[model samples]
Target: MPVPIPGNPLGYTLVYAIDSPKGPVLVDAGWNHPDAWAALRGGLLSLGIEVGSVSGVVVTHFHPDHAGLAGQVREASGAWIAMHEADAALVKLMRGFAEEEHHDFQADMLRRAGAPAEEVGAAAGQRPWVPAQPDRELRDGDLVDVPGRTLRAIHTPGHTPGHLCLHLADADRLFTGDHVLPGITPHVGIYPYDRDDVDPLGDFLTSLERVADLGGDRLLTALPAHEWIFPDVAARAAEIRHHHEEKLSTLAGLLADRAEPPTIWETAAMMTWNKPWEDLPPMLRGMAAGEAAAHLRALEARGHIRRVQGVDPVRFQALDS
Candidate 1:
């Protein structure tokens, strides 16, 4: 069912529910807003299920849009919430953050990305909301607690470290959260922007192939969190991968043509986006910079580029140049 997210451009999040012996197990709960809560309750009622009677909630990831209402669901129905172990840990980490600390971390990341003073100021002070802790920690291939049905959790960490795509083996349906959306490519970014050790884009690319192989010979009907359901998850994965590959090439070429290496902020502004960088909002600019950082990290790992050390804000140069 579509749970409305008031004021959000994406409109609503599609929260899927599977009937179990205990009650209905939700694939995802919508955003945490009064309007969203009302919509979720109403939507469940329309399906002959009650929000207060939901047996369990299987979160796709820790993103607010997807996992925001999970805690409320448990509060209302005593439902058990499950998430991938990595994301659960992330939530734990976020729980320890003070509002100021969260704001400062983002502000520092923006500064490190070479954001201007005004932009850095604009990006700061937006407090982070920590989602409710998950009651159950799920691992890849773990069977969900849905009696009589075989629902398997596939850990597909890219967009977030603990993202999971649930597989309904009995129904041949794959609930592909944000990992494989139909119209939009999921943003694979390095959070804590200073932590350059992990390669998120690389993990994302590998995850795409991992989920694609789940189809094997038969096509798995994909039910994503946003947009309508579609068939052939593999094709969609390939398309998203190609888009990133093209983006990587564009970034590398941009670096090669530059006389001096550009900071992530500069590189992001120069790279192509749906809208011009000047028009992008502060939040979007951060996302763009993060996307640039992830791609640059991938390129560095592949020997296509090298990071320039001893810089305030990190910069990169194309080795092939």
Candidate 2:
């Protein structure tokens, strides 16, 4: 079911309901907005399923678009909520944080990424919604709590540290949340910007490879959380991986040609995007810089580049430089 997310560019989240003798288990709940809740209830009603009869909610990740309505669903039906252990931990941490603390941390992170004063301010203003706590914490290979179903979780850990891709053992179908979208690449960035060797891009690529090698069957259909569902999860995974490889190559060429090391912000400005970097808004610019930092960290992990020593705002250059 496509549940509307008001004011979001992606339009909606594709929420899946798996049937069981107990009740239907929701793979993802839409955004927490009233419209989204109404859509979900109505959509299930059309299928002869009541919102109050839902058995459980197995969230793919902690993102608002996916897990936002899980709490409400549980409230309506007395259903349990489940999510990967890492994401559940994140939820606990976030729920404990004060708004001012979160704002300050984000601002500091952007500053470390070498963002301009304005961009830092704008990006720091953006706050995340507190997610619902999960009753059941899942790990990779664990089966979801859907009676008479074999929906197993696979820890993908890229877009988020605890991102999960579920596989239906009975039907051979995969519910690839944001980990494998058909139309757009998911954002993967290192958070807690001061940590060394935190390579989110590297994790993303490895996760992609794992998904691609799942069964090697070309006809396996993948039901992603957004956009049109596509056949052959392996093919889509390979395409996304190739796109990142090309981006890594581009970043390498850029660093080789530059006379001095570039900060993450400058490196991001130099990379290609949908529009010119100058046209991007401050929040988007911050995101771009974080993405650039992930790519730079991946390169450093492979010994192709290194961080410049003793820099306030961190900078990276080719290893030979």
Q: What is the TM-score of each candidate against the true structure?
A: 0.97, 0.96
Q: How many residue pairs clash in each candidate at the backbone level?
A: 0, 0
Model 2 TM-score, 2 decimals? 0.96
Residue by residue across 39-87, what tens digits does model 2's lDDT show? 9999999999999999999999999999999999999999999999999
Residue 72 lDDT in candidate 2: 99
Return the top candidate by TM-score. 1
User: lDDT per model, in order?
Assistant: 0.89, 0.89
Which residue pairs clash in candidate 1?
A: none
The local lDDT score (0 to 100) that residue 245 gets in candidate 1 is 93
Q: After aligning candidate 1 to the native by TM-score, how far in Å is the CA of 290 from where it should be?
A: 1.2
Model 1: what TM-score?
Answer: 0.97
Give residue 69's error in model 1 in angstroms.
Answer: 0.8
